[model samples]
Target chain A: MSQKAHDIFFRSNAPVTVDEDKCIAHKGCTVCVEVCPMDLLAINPLTQKAYMQFDECWYCMPCETDCPTGAVKVEIPYLLR
Target chain B: MSLDNFLNLEQEYDIVVIGGGTAGPMAAIKAKERNPNLRILLLDKANVKRSGAISMGMDGLNNAVIPGHATPEQYTREITIANDGIVNQATVYAYAKHSFTTIEQLDRWGVKFEKDGTGDYAVKKVHHMGSYVLPMPEGHDIKKVLYRQLKRAKIAITNRIVSTRLLTDASGAVCGVLGFDCRSADFHIIKAKAVILCCGAAGRLGLPASGYLMGTYENPTNAGDGYAMAYHAGAELANLECFQINPLIKDYNGPACAYVTGPLGGYTANNKGNRFIECDYWSGQMMWEFYQELQGGNGPVFLKLDHLAEETIQTIEHILHSNERPSRGQFHANRNTDYRHKMVEMHISEIGFCSGHSASGVWVNERAETSVPGLYSAGDMAAVPHNYMLGAFTYGWFAGHSAADYVAGKEFSALDKEQIAREKQRVYAPLLREHGLPPAQVEYKLRRFVNDYLQPPKVTRKMELALERFDQIEEDIAQLKAANPHELMRAMEVAVIRDCAEMAARASLFRQESRWGLYHHRVDFPERDDANWFYHCHLKKDQSGRMVSHKREVEPYLIPLDDHERNAYDKLRLKAANG
Candidate 1:
């Protein structure tokens, strides 16, 4: 399969983004990945950060606020806001 | 197919409430009643009938009042004692004083109650409110009431929705919320002066059983969308720690104490059927005070429930049988899917299930402000305010009022685009990756570990191992990828599981002693540990993104019930009877 040009829109299956410096890697991101239920999460080896595979992602966070580390963050679509 | 039109829709309202539970409708209706012609909209992921975990027209009631029988003071003490007094005094009163009114309002709206021919409503015995305990309404019943009210009051009801982001203008205040109607899969731009998140908790995310619905009453629609949405909106949260536990069931299998409480009727047993609670765990006081015989000891200890009095057996049988209701498990859209249905059937169906699942959630003040601005939390979603399980009615009202109050303000500002962009990246980065195990794997491993190590009570060095297990599970979860909505939701359950772990760990570490109901085991701390542990565990969402756990002193109050509040209430009770 070819790599899809990751379009990280809120409504899309894409998970949010990550700023390396800002992430505490507090285990919260893991929750967001699992909460989505669908295999929406794809961890990047190079960045050690989370990114959404839009096509695969379902937009709920099960590992939601459970993480003590608070690494995972949610981004609502700008339009809805 | 185009969500743009919906996304660009700018809507203004006198009040914008997030949840449609018992309290949300009340707040919206009351606000409108407080002022007619107020444009108010109640946004919920599902129908208003099933907004919260618990609804009206059921046996559960906050008003535990019995005429010429029970008193609120005793009720207060029993509850406070069960919660170890971590409950908010004002909050306790808020529920205690207004319970009658809550039921009355529901009744006025056509909520049915199982009452006696004498025109008196019955009580759950355990859930007695002040002077009158209201009847439990079915989730469906509540939806009907809200549907009628919303239509009549001209309140807009948005359904099949999930709020994804909290929109703040240039200033730090809330502008509105970004959400989507899952049924249409169309994103919506909910621009409002303020946003209130009444979506319930991650309890739906915990193990096979979630919250009140654990025993076949699970609400899959209660996906942690609200908590996640609120966290991203920049509102701080508290006590993301402290999930209610009693995820315990009467299933006849497992290893060690963590697996099963063994037998019922005060008997304790292990795998070999030898008496455990009676032989080992039972205290001297228990042996002397209680008169149950502990014959035939091995590993599993079981109180001989057979040949017991019919009435006594019937009571226990009723509780066990009541677990048959399929309302909770069948309600959530996610549970119907193959992956999740297997889970619900496997664990929840195993004979013994406890209503004691969990009662902890986000921490909030009387005003319902979380750690962040332009946001609030409520319901079972709210953290450990008092050690008691606050139902949908209380938190629903609190969050609704708090958020509505916050939004009514005129001050407005815009958010810095740079920070917003950064937040945007944080929110969806995980969805774009290709590598790692699926979120479902992480969810499974989490359930497996927490069930083994951190279930409750016996706090020990074992927690470190559990935490380590969590670490591995975390890595595994980070790898999960979704195939569709079904798979995605199962994965989401993992997120809730992780939160429960964190909350449990937070309380476990801080509370070096055992206390409270259902979960607080004596071997864990051996004492209430009130002096150091009476405070509430406050959790919040930091920019890095999970729970930021902390502690706050539970406000101590006298109410000065002083014989007078008691006398006054007693007289009122009499007057109510006569009238």
Candidate 2:
């Protein structure tokens, strides 16, 4: 195939953040990940801590509200903020 | 990425309910209750535990026709006037009569409602005429309550499957569904005797003013998937031009929620801190006045609660912060806005299709049956004007029982191999291609065009241009690439959004006259032409697979509304000077 198409990346900040010290993802807690309607959060494999994988947060705040521990924080997406 | 390499899973069900949101869960549970032997499957793109519009749960029922507070006839009349008389009165009346029963059912299921000292249901007056706003102070766990009911009713649920299309048999009746898992990229070919669509509003059709794609008033996950699927299945969609435009908190895009706070003494006011409209009901007329206030140099409307007592402010905060978009409290705090000190700034939201707020959705009858047999619709997606959460539950009960009766002794039709194969190829094409356009970028561009041309104060020429742009976006959709299953779900949604954009433009162009306040406001046709455009404008896919638009006669009124009652919503603006 010709080099007619190539993927380009753009930098964007994830509005949702998880506190490493408070996150219990390592202890098999995926409450935040499971409850996110957008499926934006995930457990980082290397650290086994919950983190936002995708920048597409609705700011509806299910992850933060349903987090087993108070580790998750959802900010207004930067464009809106 | 050949078809042979992919895993295909086939499931058999008596009925499949798409969208495990407010209505889908109710439909599934009620169907199982109606006929325990029937196997029902309830699915959602997100987890059933937290899905759809009420993901974080709602603050109050906007239209709860509880007895003693309001009669079914009165509520029906109110909605008829609010929708500018383009409603199927039988559907509205049916929802009205069953409203109390639905509320009682929720009460029995552990959902709490505010009550007075006399133990009466404390329904508040918020509509232009009736007292319908019933507050749910502890409504944050409404989904949890519904989930418990689902388990008790023995209803099966599959979460994280994004339904793409409805499969129809040779006779053109819906028989099954086609979708893929958003995480595993596995195909779900569900064969069903009946399919109930409860997919909430076409929320992601227009770009929010903030330019954030996901910061939509409706759950961004909705993306008009139900509207697109119903159109493809040849179901008629009513009043697509009557868009859902709400007065939301500026930048935050969620409802400033006058319905919740209005009964507690908060009112929508202009920047001068004076009330402009007489009523806080979210009718199109009320929004027209709101739009006038914003554009007429008295810009930036606010939810005025600053004059309330300190205790009242705290009480407002407790209920508003804890339920229905709880990030609201944080949003206020981030801006240093407090109900006691500063009024929350409000702005007009971008347009979308939602019968829950405005009249634009899949056309269904009193029994929740669409034009296509065996296909039922309910909730925000179904065309029941002003049918909020309570109506969702009521219509859902109707759909469930109707579908339960529909599936009795009805054998599943033979699956179309060609349809399934074609859908499989279309679904996996993005993943098969090495490189192409991204779904998010495509969606953003499409929605931007929707706002540009389709957002009302609509012009004939701009809408024509929008059709042209939407065609180009259709071409762009063919080149979309998805790296994984999650992006693939979004890629499919872009196509859905494009379909809705075209539908919105076509429906607006077909109407030719302005009616529903700012919703169908045509710059060219500024007058409400009830003489010619009194009927409902419906859109659907014709026999040739071409999108077509036409008019349907409005059903004769079940309960007659006097001339004064018919014009009630038109007088929402206060005749007195601003105070």
Clashes of each: 123, 0
What is the alpha-carbon lDDT of model 1 when measured against the actual structure? 0.46
Q: How well is each residue in A7-75 modelled by candidate 2, as lDDT tens digits?
A: 678898878989999999999998998888888888899999999988899988889888888999989
**Per-residue CA lDDT of candidate 1, range B9-70, in tens?**
34556556776755567666665664564577888754564445433223334343444445
Candidate 2: segments with Cα more than 4 A from true spot:
A1-5, B577-579
Two-chain DockQ for each candidate model:
0.02, 0.79
TM-score attained by chain A of model 1: 0.47
How does model 2 fare in lDDT? Answer: 0.91
Error of 2 at B150 (Å): 0.4
* Tens digit of per-residue lDDT, candidate 2, span B155-239: 9899899999899999999999999999889999999999999999999999999998898999988889999999999999999
Tell me each candidate's TM-score: 0.63, 0.99
DockQ of 2: 0.79
